[model samples]
Target chain A: MTLVKVYVNYKKSILNPEAQAIHSALNRLGYSNISDVKLGKYFEITVDDDSKDIDSEINEICDKLLANVNMESYRYEIVEGANA
Target chain B: MTLVKVYVNYKKSILNPEAQAIHSALNRLGYSNISDVKLGKYFEITVDDDSKDIDSEINEICDKLLANVNMESYRYEIVEGANA
Candidate 1:
């Protein structure tokens, strides 16, 4: 099987209130050295070894489901032997 | 500045309904080649370069605020030159 690690995050132009809240909370907790905090979703997908055109398939999946293309962007890496 | 990438995920024994839902949705979408799916949180924290003991500080931050240690586990990597 192939283990695909996908990271979906907001675009730079978008304002992420949750991330801002986390940053404020961190500062309140005394982590003043932290300059910024950004939050996103991560996915570990296990695909059958027989998949042809895996890259295209992954892109399609990300566009169709994993990420909000209008406000978010995504990137993925394929790990050949990692456990799902 | 240092960019810390933190990945927080449920422990293997924990039930992840969101992941299950995504998996089932994929199957319904005719992507049967996908065997499994796991979902998690990803954080990008940018910290000032002046901080000493970054590793310890990061661990403390994760334990205190970023993760629910009882149900989730987290790992982080320090990327030296990545833009926050």
Candidate 2:
């Protein structure tokens, strides 16, 4: 088995409503200095073995589907593992 | 300033199409053993210095905005920083 970790986020230049909401929530919770907020996500994927050159294949996936080139940024790391 | 990191992910029980695409990419790239894939994202936010009890404030923000209790999960870490 192969383990992959992916990180995706909105580009810095874009406005994020979700982040803004988070900022207000922080304000209500009592933090006065929290002028801004940005939200992000993380994921782990486990793949079964059917191919040979896994890393390159995964990078292709990132380039094509896992990431949106227009507004989001993403990076992935691979960790070889013992599983199905 | 306060540095906040949020990690949001789909529950294990959920189906992730992004992850599925990544899996195929890995297969194409040469990792034959990779049968499945899951995608996730990460974000870093800087909050200005204005509140006391920053940790609790950030936690509340997480509960309200950064995380989705129904399908996605989130966790945050605060790093005291040398900036506004």
Candidate 3:
């Protein structure tokens, strides 16, 4: 099986409220030096060994259901010989 | 600033229905080689430079909020001189 790891984050042009809230909370908790506290999602997908073109196949899956193309940007890396 | 990345995954002892559903979907979509598709959460936290003991501080935060020790296993990495 191929392990495909996807990292999804808000587009650079968009402002994320959850990230802002975390930033504020960090400051309040005495982390004044922290900045750009962006929050994002991560997915670890295990693709079948039978896949012919694993790279493109994973990309297609990400575009279809894993990522919100409108406001979010995503990237993935494939690791060979992984179970999950 | 320090960038802390926490990867949370379900314990091996538990059964993850979401992962199973994804596995089934992949098979239906013709990915019969796939197996052991596990689902998990990821967190990227930006901590202030003012932190004295970054390692311990990040661990404290993860134990308190980022990870639920009951059913999830988590690991983190600390990157120095990063914003997020």
Candidate 4:
């Protein structure tokens, strides 16, 4: 079995409302030193080892349905011999 | 500086299409056995260490901006004296 982990996040240059809200809250809470608040996301997938096309599958998913390539960036890794 | 690491992901029970694509990819890659694929996200925020009220700030951010609370799940940890 192959274990794949994906991490997705807003582009660094893009404006994130969530981070801004967090910044505002932190400022109000007297933790004003918080410079920047960025939001990120992740995913862990377990796949059957019988197929050897995980990368293409992941690419298609990212391109078609999983993420908005224009706004979010993602990376993933496949683990070998893990939980096999 | 306080390092706050947040991990946001689809609730464990949610259906993840990204993972499914990867699952198919693995099967094509010749290393099948993967059962499911899930997508997740992360955020690493740096807050001013001088403030003792980071918890509230984080909470508000999570509720109002950082996470949807309705579909995604998130968690964060704040470090003390690590980068001071």
On TM-score, the leading prediction is 1
Q: Give i-RMS (Å) per prediction.
A: 0.6, 3.6, 2.4, 3.4
Q: Model 1, B2-84: lDDT tens per residue?
A: 99999999999999999999999999999999999999999999999888899999999999999999999999999997765
Per-residue lDDT over A1-81 for candidate 1, one digit per residue giving the tens place of the 0 to 100 score: 999999999999999999999999999999899999999999999999889899999999999999999999999999997
What TM-score results for chain B in every one of the models?
0.96, 0.76, 0.90, 0.80
Q: Candidate 3 — which pairs collide?
A: A34-B48, A48-B33, A48-B34
lDDT value, residue A39 of candidate 2 = 58
lDDT per residue as tens, model 3, B1-84: 678887888888978898788778877877666665667776777766777887887776667666688888888888877744
Query: Candidate 1's error at B83, in angstroms?
Result: 3.8
- Candidate 2 lDDT tens digits, B24-76: 76668665665666555565767777666767766666567665777777667
| CA shift of A4, model 3, Å | 1.9
lDDT per residue, candidate 4, A22-65, as tens digits?
67876786556778677666767666666557798767656654
lDDT of 1 at A29: 91
Off by over 4 Å in 2: A24-30, A49-52, A80-84, B13-33, B39-41, B49-52, B80-84
In angstroms, the error of model 1 at B50 is 1.4
lDDT of each: 0.96, 0.67, 0.76, 0.71
Look at candidate 3 and tell me the lDDT of residue A31: 57
What CAPRI grade goes to candidate 4? medium
In order of TM-score, best first, we have 1, 3, 2, 4
